[model samples]
Target: MGLAGALATPAHGDTKAPAVVNDARLEAAYVIMGDGFATVRIVTGAAGCPALTIDAKAQPMIVRAPHASLPLRPTASTIANSKPSVFPITVCEASLPPGAKRASVDGRPLPMPRPVIRRIVVIGDTGCRLKASENAYQACNDPEAYPFAIVAAHAAAWHPDLVIHVGDYLYRENPCAPGHAGCAGSPWGYGWDSWKADFFTPGAALLAAAPWTVTRGNHESCERAGQGWWRLLDPRAMQPRHDCNDAADDVTGNYSAPYRVSLGQGAQVVVMDLSHAGKKNIAADDPRYDEFVSTHDALARYARNATFTFATDHYPILGVTIPDGEPDKPPKAGNKAFQSTFGQVDKGLVPAGVDVLLAGHVHLWEHVDYSGNTPSQFIAGFSGTQEDAVPLPSRLPVDTSPLPGVTIRQFDAWTDGFGYMTMERTGARSWKVTVRHADGSLLRRCRIRGNHTYCEPIFG
Candidate 1:
């Protein structure tokens, strides 16, 4: 299907509730929001999707679909090869009633979305860094140095009703050097072992805490961890994901249509596959520039019907980042691709109705409130991965511009350490967001009202 045709699938709004399921050997099973249905996905060593009993009757799980693993390059080195190793993993999925209250995998009770969601945990960039290209290797074995597991546990303990992971789930793209104590013995490949170590294991608690809404990150781009991402966490059907393993077609592989996940009462969350947008400014004549315009237009259309809307795209439409080695350099706006495409789509970038823009590519927690008009932007990329660069100034220069023609009225930026944010619904149109460090200590508290968000430190 063409990119537009592929995007026609709706996101969510099924009336059937979720129900209990039973299966042993299931590595992970949870309800996920996807195009037009609430899906039950499971990873197991077993060969096929397990059967789940729904409302006292057994129903077949996802029909067997071809696995998305690519044809391996057998000629490659036996160890530390550039190619990803195939694991004996069977990932299967099937749609389920959205209202089911109880679920279990391998007799372990799994989580389900609350009938009415009141609290949500948002996180992103959660993987141990073991990259050879950048010469960055984090101590995957050190809890203090790489605290995603601890952070996920603390996040689960908060008892969030729903969880949204912004992206960058797998980052161990290269093997650890023999003498490097930091990433010693870490599974450093694009295979399941790396994915399990970097994400699934560390984030197990939160994964089981509630239904998740996942956004695709650049790390999961076609050339990076894209293979593992499609096989494991993509919320879409298996078609485009299978295509993601190759550059056979145009950009449609990693990119996807925006879909709506209803928050009930007319409020919804629109998920955008912004994984393909690179840091470089795309020229007006670039083919991808037009594709991105369509992407942005589709997003605006999806949010038009919702009474309230929260948008999730891994690439920050507006964010602050510094040059790799020049931490002292002035902070600059990120995502020039979006700036070019969205600038042409709508002068506002996102349509005016989008209440909050949630993203996580920057590797820190930040919130920017605009003086004029625009959705308040929240960057929650500091969940687990090595926090990026040095800390941003407590106050950016008065003339700081995160996106074209957008003035920052006030903002709160934090990169002191690894952290996550929790959003608790305070009213129909308002939510209270709390930012916390890896230890789960409160850093900032903010209130949401329409497109405005104002934050203050928990303590002076």
Candidate 2:
């Protein structure tokens, strides 16, 4: 009998079932040589006798687990195939094996391996363009404008392990530039084939680089394409996937998968599809809208050290101000139709730990802060269009009720430019968000650090 078995044999009157923990919490096991980093080896099963050996002089040091368990099959430096693959797992310091030598429970070898690390990149509201002037705004989709190429360049330059596109991939009914033949095969406008040809083909360089997490915006509404949008991109459409809604008239009804991304250390990001009918193309008070909110509420409870959580959709809540007497009024309700989207964000996200909310669709740039001091929000979507620069208004509508330390930059100075933002981890618990122009010119930079707060703006 093995040591564990022998110990369980009992000496005399100890007749209680030998305690055996099958689902015991598992941590990391490390072995060090000299002063350098330790090399860890893990076995797959209980019999594997995974013995951990460490240098006598070297003591145990807590290291964060790098491996993150995923639902998909793991991808290990392998080329892309039709088959799916999983990312390397994440590991933490607590996961390490105890003691400086072989770890054996009564001589049973414990098996464990080093953790894996992954990189991630996030972008939103790319490719969708709406109502551009014939000649002036024509450059948006021009084959030469290299819309896809730009995305590709950014991907190549950063080489993120994964990509998160926050929606607005296609703008149905929005006429193509002057030259594009027509929306011929599109299901809504030209169909998936046309979109694949224009969007997928052009942006092939970047799309090919990483796995994608796609979200929906107002443009994906059925009113625009029936059920085409959901069919094309939803990972769980036909498969009875996770729905934040259940009852017929439930207020909480979400349509997308809830994914947690670990950015190493204790930091994690929980991404949710917050699209509700109330703010966009659908009717106000759409049950699905409530579902989106509830789903996020559930996620906010779990992600730890998640200093910041970002929500994305294709609508802007603050920033652009219509001329006092302008004839055209904003939408009455829903995401695309009006300014009411802010109410949804106010009621649903802030309390749930969302530090930043990203939106587009106004075709103009705007940033908002509900909590005057900490936690910032922004609307960055001037991509793929040609519009004249309009300065930000001096007087801005600031939501002071929440008082969550949020700030909105009322940029009266708006300029015609295609741009993207880069979020990088600069310190143990801080992220630097930099918004840049098409040519990589820095436009705005803010450092997000501690207790949902952002530092003063540093302009380019």
Candidate 3:
């Protein structure tokens, strides 16, 4: 069956809920508000429906909880580069019942809000690519090979309080050849159908489990899937950009804004966008460079307020694993950007109380501890996407290792199977981070105290 046909077919024993106009069901499940109060977003494919009205009252697309009737609000704007502009999404804020284990959306049950947030699951770069010419190891058609479905299921089973996806949600840009395993008759363009197959469907379970803080990766560029990125995942207000064509230097519509997620008291996660800043020496006059600097300074100020602060972005600041076919040279521009902003050990540009720097892009996993730096850097991009060959242990060595006072204390890299990181807050000042494979096999575990990290092998 084709992608849309397959989705239209209901799962076994799933009583078909009353269909809105054009059979719109909930797509891209997410919680907007994090605390005890929650605002849920449900995207529907019903064309021209902009908001959902519950009962006879015309609600502004926001639904309050405790069994409220919701009706389709038929108003939505067309996305740039999208066909027909048929996807209209709505957001509803509801007060989940106390001690409620599950909540209902349009009569469909879903996991409820957590009383407290202690565990957070981090995954990234999970889009599946079907082109055989790309030389990916997994067979795209086989669910077992392209196991993001399984990965998302495992993550949902853990019942995390929150999910932090460091970006790259859509990937099926190239069409699959005839008779390819999972690609035969599949939708191949950058549209709602492709997104449903690549992300929404496989990610449904996890998306319903808890709220998510999403980052914008390079794959989410306007030229590639920017329209979908803005419509589906971005938490910020939408601002349409007409210049979303496929151009290498085009950075329009790339949201460079920085936002923060409060993780209870004394902790917060700050998300920044460095998608537009390419791996070249960004001139001081460049707006992207200026934005990066201002964002970095804002992160520094946030660090001072929170006892434990985590900064996440799509690009890695240090020790990036070179992609398979890319050149072996160091990332001069990325390094320069970091040095000019956060890597200034002598000038104290790196902020205090920032415990961790989480990033993804290189498709490998690494944990780097600096001798004098406040935050330990972690690369957890090995969620489900094809991984690049693991670089040598000492690959991409820092040019000026002992930069004034900063020194590389220790570094570990892994380029094997797909995996994710789970952070469990054990105490007010203590937390445990575990790196596990897609199937829940423990790979490594570490303890974080103040700003120091000590990790040991799980079975060594």
Candidate 4:
């Protein structure tokens, strides 16, 4: 809150509260995109909540939302699935107006949203893969194998005005096989340790560099890392059934209402909670299908009013993915569930007013342009997770489509392994995007004009 946050009377003699928690361990402090404002979030090891300054005066932060700024007890679901956490975590947040000028927690500085968002880093599906389902284990200690820290450092060095993690922050779900050196000793399960290792530890630099707009991926679904998603990044007020505490309440836990984040300069992003969406199509009769319809309707309303709108969901509605286990393997396609639901809702999948679509989950970088009044889709799913060993065809068929009406006008992809993407706003209606590898090596450069994205070739 360098200064978008205005002053609020300190809650209950907050001036007496210590602005610097000299005794508590400030594990993390960063700004994340709030519902309409910016929220200053901190994870501390102390039982006592720390204090922050809105301008020159200190204000005490309450517990987590809808109640106090306090931590929730781990439900039975977590008790049975995760190990006892070594760190005592208290997740707390305080909102600062979009115009707050100065803000600090425990005397440490925190970055604030810029008056004009000019540089943005888009990342997705970032984590070390440690899944027993597929018997896949990434070398967590190897930089080349799991380069999220490097990618984040590079993004921070670029001086981004804002950061958007498309989704899927947790992946160290299952343990490393006994004596397997690749992922030996790495934390697993949905506890604080797992989340710390998976995201917070690796993404420290970028977290401090700019405020983040967090998106939830399938990995963060109620069935997976949803518990941590709610505690740390879901960008919504804490609610009961949404905590992923019981299987009985999964219908509520999985589907969250969509909201918009207005970035200055006539640009806004509609964030959707389609983490429940995956490879299988959700039939129209299913109760969850209505959630997609609601999201589509909300996006239409948002797009109709904004000059430039971006639909940021974890899954790409009209993207090109390298499908795993398919015969030839180069059978590239888009998200099936979204295609089915959005196809029926709108002919182009994306509503008429949205200009850009940002997502991750395919574990690669892709840019797909369409033939009609369709939005361009950019996938930055190459952040860290190991990708399909089966590679995509060097050239994708352009006459084809992900759905019935959205014809592919152009296609581009790269990042054999880990990487990230950046968008630099250049004009009122235009921006330039760069695709970079884990080491920040430039792979492609593109320009965006409304819904169209044109990128220079990785080789040419």
Residue-level lDDT of model 3, residues 111-191, one tens digit each, is: 544545699999988887643345433455666666788788888888898898887777666556555666566654456
**To one decimal, what is the Cα RMSD in angstroms of model 2 from the true structure?**
14.8
Arrange candidates by lDDT, descending: 4, 1, 3, 2
Error of 2 at 171 (Å): 2.5
- For residue 207, what is the lDDT in candidate 3? 86
What do the candidate models score in CA lDDT, each in turn?
0.75, 0.41, 0.62, 0.78
1 or 3, greater by TM-score: 1
Residue 129, candidate 3: alpha-carbon lDDT = 65
Residue 204 accuracy (lDDT) in model 2: 55
TM-score against native, each model: 0.89, 0.56, 0.78, 0.90
lDDT of 1 by residue, 1-460 (tens): 5322332332233233233334466776776777555666778766665656565556555422333456442111233357745666777665566577666544456677666678899999999987775677889999999999999999999999889889899878777878889788888667778888998888888888888888999888766677667767776655733545555643666677778777776778888887878777889888778778887787778777777889999888877667567877887755678777888778777787788999988888888888576888899999888866567777777778855667887777887788889999878788999999888888998999888999999852
Order of the predicted models by TM-score, top scorer first: 4, 1, 3, 2
Please report the candidate that would top lDDT against the real structure.
4
Worst 10 residues of 4 by lDDT: 1-10
Q: lDDT by residue for model 4 over 226-335, one digit each (tens)?
A: 77788778766666688876767778999887888877877887889888787778898987788988888888998898889888999888777656566465555667
Say which prediction, candidate 1 or candidate 2, comes out ahead on TM-score: 1
Could you give candidate 2's per-residue lDDT for residues 125-198 as a string of tens digits? 55534333222323443533535457556654666544556556654334444355432222214244334443
Q: After superposition, how far is residue 209 of candidate 2 from its true place, in Å?
A: 2.8
Candidate 3 off by > 4 Å: 1-24, 33-38, 47-103, 110-115, 130-138, 178-182, 240-252, 323-334, 340-349, 394-404
